[model samples]
Target: MPLALYLLALAVFAMGTSEFMLAGLVPEIAAGLDVSVGSAGLLTSAFAAGMILGAPVMAAFARPWPARSMLLGCLMIFTMCHVIAALTPSFAVLFATRLVAAMANAGFLAVALRTATRLVAPDRKGRALAILLSGTTIAIVAGVPAGSLLGTALGWRATFWAVAVLCLPAAVGIATGIRPAGRTSLGEPDHEPSLRAELAQLRTPHVLIAMLLGALVNGGTFAAFTYLAPVVTATAGLDPVWVPVALMLFGTGSFAGIVVAGRLSDAHPRLVLGIASPVLFAGWLILALCAARPVLLLSLIIVQGVLAFAVGGTLIARVLYAASAAPTMGGSYATAALNLGAAAGPAIGALALAGHDELAPVWVAAVLTGTATLMVLPSLRLIAPRAHRVAPTG
Candidate 1:
């Protein structure tokens, strides 16, 4: 992988940390702003909503710009938003800043993925994407926890300040490491597609299916993951302290899973999805059935993490591959789909939890993942006949 790829990953790490760190700091923010915990929680929802709406808009507007310029602009905006957020006194101001930050974050991710894919060979696009996405996994494993700890020690505002500081290096790295010409192939500069042409690409059945698959995969994983703390503690009868340990194990599994999936995706994107969907469904089912068994629950959580993330690179590669005619919009749509799923999963999990069963989220996840599994074969079949018609673009 090129140094530019790692620079993109560094940008993702900062964005991912900002995206997730809010979860741990909600109570602090609530107390600081004199709002209810539920009110403070709206910040997270706002960010997701921004990502859901902002991605396609950003992609459309950035259609004519070089990918590197778009990325740098997004990072600069993201960094400035965080600084403003850190200084804001009103909860409303903080919420607005987060929303804007998320928009910038969405733009950065869409452009970064497009840029990374262009930098590598067609066959190595999967690994390039995986390397870029690994930043998010690393953020989950280390950054979120570190931010939580920093919040506890120095205040939530300080954590935001730290994230702002972190963005500086990523901005510098992108500016220095990625050459403008490296953004796309020589042919791409002359054949920039119109926004209409890009939008038309989404009408492709395989492209739509790939987006749907991305949504289902993420929705299912988060549906269960969102409520894991309670399930592990109350349902599994595990010590509350062990919850963090379980989460770390899950993150570790995700890191490993994405790397393995990246390699598999190069030759067998469909195979990666096919295997991951079933394994994730089975893992969730096992968790639902054995929630009361501490040992079994713990083991299943790690296994489920691996199975869940093993499909990440494949899902991403599939979307990009399917929409090779309009890579930027395709990548943006994929980001939107994933964020939509992230937002939906918790809502679905909340509905399942209304039954007052701690294990209900696990069952819900299993059903969603199983549905994703069912979509895979049909999606592949649809893509086969059209594969030759679609021209690859960056």
Candidate 2:
């Protein structure tokens, strides 16, 4: 609820816009750089790969620094990379800049999660995280579409320039709004865990399960979502113009879901995941079965959106709570694990597409989410005790 949390959300909005805006601009980028669209699509993969590799390493190195400083530095680097990306003439240069920008994005998010949780009461950590991550949902709803329009009107380069300009205010907000005392209160100098100790926490059973859960949950949703366009148009027989409308509806559902999940997670994270996982499985299953009904499919899309994001706040809360002693590293692992799932989901969907029809992704998502449900059942025993002990003390 602090101003600092909103500022962090602003930073996330800038990064999320940059991450997703590329999807809409891929064709323009391909044409501008004289490359194939398939090649240009690799730019998205590059950013995800950078986040997967950069997050834990950045967290380790940044373990000793003030969270505010790390966040500000990452924002500066991210902004500069976007500026270079806007100006780059070569595809290779643009790709490299995207990688750097994603690395900065990952670093900023990991630190932001830790900082946001620290800013609030222990019981409110889930809500704070949800508010921070809502920036991404907002980006999907508004920023990506606006960037696409901007690219059409001005140029893809202009969109990048606009994103760079957007970061300036977020960076200034962090520098001014977050105090040194707040940063120190999160993790005192004497209590800072060593890199080895933090890394060792990954070997804990509950922590590892939390990471796996994060990956599978994201993988399931994205497996279907990554190919939503063709499924909605060709399979569902919807007008192509309705694709953006469907996406906007999904984003709206996601925003609402995260807020509700955040509140539920404050009291019972396990129960939240228990309900969410089944909802996700059923949503995808129904979507697959009713793919030919345009109205039904659209309704299911919104349901899927809510179910997909409903688990997000709880997942992060579970990881941070289970690994409370190594929260920075745990947060980084959560980010990296989720990105790995993001990468894997599309690959799984692509394979399903190669062997089956467009509706295959929906079924694939159902199976993945169903598996996530089963995974959570066993982990509940491990997480419940920790949840009880972590009641808000401050």
Candidate 3:
């Protein structure tokens, strides 16, 4: 694998940490900005909105540029936005920066996704993507918590400054690691994808369904993951200190899941998905029922995290492979799909929480995951007809 792939993951680690660390700083931000905690929470939502809107739009705009250029350029914008965020006093100004920074984050991810897969051979695409996705798992396990601790000790502004500064080394590394278009064959699009062709893929049944499956599965995963702290503490009656340990376990399981998926997906994508999806969903149902038990809840948290990303990482690889021909735009489709799910999942989980049942989110997750599993059958049939050629055990 290219060092550039790791650099790209570095970029993802910074952005992913920025994406989630806000949850820990909401109180600080609300106090500093003289707004309600709910208002500060909207900044996070606004960031998601920027990601959802920017993925396809910014990707289309940058398709003609060299991959390295777009990536470095986006990193600069993202970094500058965070700097402005740290310096800004007005809530509105900070919110504007989140929007711009998220758009840049969206663009970087779109290009990085395509770039990572292109760096490796077809059979290793899953592994390549797993490496990139590990940045997020690692960020969740380590970076976000670290950022929160930093913010608590220093200030929220210091946390923003740290995120901005983190981008510098990654920028330097990526600039050195990724070959420029003039030097490398893979660093630039051979042909700019036509708008019509990009749109056409949305109409293709398998491609469309694969993207939707990615979203649905992600939605289901986030539905439970978003409320995990509450679920373990309230439902399972674990002490508040155990919450962080639970999160770490989930993050560790996520990393393990990606590693496992990377190894199995190329040869057994069908079998993995067919077997894991139901098991994943069943795991959620079990959690919903047994979350009152601390040991079981803790154990299943790791299992659920493992299954969620194993299923998720494969879905991403499937999206990339299905839209392989549209090298310039494939990543944007994936970005849009996953973010759509990311946006919806937490909202659904929040709604489920309105009924006073800590386990309601788990039940909703089970339903969403069950639907995702059902959706996958048709996608598998269409995306890989060879699945029909393989034995039932496969």
Candidate 4:
């Protein structure tokens, strides 16, 4: 809601773009570097792995610095990584640059989420988070397509250069719009989180369940989403040019879902997951069954995007609420689970595709979503014991 929030979101947009833009640029990068596409795909995997490992490390070690400073530092690191990526000639150097870029992204997201949650009214925390995170969805909408086009027109190197250019405006905006430490009551003084104590909080069954559910759902979603372009083109018979348009539709649905999910989180975080998980499962099922119809398949993808994304904010907020003892550590683990899911999804989907055709991946995704729904049931029940009493009845 505040100007600072949008500035933070803008930074997130740039970071998110840089992180995933590699997926579109992989073929071009592989060709330029005289490597196979499979090898170039490693660039994307390396980024996710970096996020998986670097997020907690950054959160734990950088706990003493002010939030704004951390964010600025992250942006600088990201900008430098992009610059190196653009200028580097050797494939090894380019790969290393991507890894560094991934680390910067992980740090930025960890701090950005923390800052966004703290910046809003207690009752509006969900909406605030959704606003900030929509930047990632916005990247899927705008960044991937633009990156792909840029890669096609100029070169993959030019796309990296474009990201570096975008970071300049993002830095300036963050500096201008963000409140300095001690300026806003919401931006409290830094309190170093105890990693040991935070790890101890995992002994709580609810927390464990939340982590499991987060990983499962995220892995399932990414498993399907990572390969969406091929699935739509090969199975649904859509034009290749339409893949980005379909992805844009997914992003639109997700962005809308995020706004509504924020309101539902404040009302009933636990129940919202129950409602959303089923819809996500159904969406996958429909996609699997109607694989021959481009229109029907795209419709299902839209629904999947909306319902799946709607639960994200609610689930993360629920994890934080459940882990009242040490939110920072809890927050870090939640993000770690998310990254783990991101890593797992594609692997599982690739396995599913090994012995079958394009439509086979949809079945795998459906199974994963269904399993995730089942895994989440106990935790959802634990949180909303009264069925309807998901939030404090104030």
TM-score, per-candidate, Cα-based = 0.95, 0.95, 0.95, 0.93
User: Candidates sorted by lDDT, descending order?
Assistant: 3, 2, 1, 4
RMSD (Å) of each candidate, 1 decimal: 2.3, 2.5, 3.2, 2.9
**Clash counts for all predictions:** 0, 0, 0, 0
**Poorest stretch of ten by lDDT in candidate 2:** 385-394
Candidate 1 has its poorest 10 consecutive residues by lDDT at 385-394
User: Model 3 — TM-score against the truth?
Assistant: 0.95
* lDDT of candidate 1 at residue 51, scale 0 to 100: 92
Candidate 4 structure quality by residue, lDDT tens digits, 1-394: 7888888878878887887788778888888999899988888888888888878888776667777788889899999999988988788888888788887788887777777767776456667777887888888789878988898999999999988998998899887776667534353335644767766777777666666677777787788888888878888888899888888888777777777777787667766887788888888888888878988888888888888778765666666555545545555666777788888888888888897887666777788779878877766765444533333311
**Over the stretch 159-229, how does candidate 2's per-residue lDDT look in tens digits?**
99999999999999999988754443344335666777878887888777877887888888778877888
lDDT of 3 by residue, 4-45 (tens): 889999999999999988978999999998999999999988
After superposition, the stretches of candidate 3 with alpha carbons farther than 4 Å from their true spots are 182-192, 387-394
Residue pairs clashing in model 3 are none
> Which whole-number lDDT from 0 to 100 does residue 252 have in model 4?
78
Q: Which has the better lDDT: candidate 2, or candidate 4?
A: 2
The residue-by-residue lDDT of candidate 1 on 274-390, one tens digit each, is: 566777788888789888998888888888778888885578677777777786687798788879888898889888898578888778888888898887866665542333333
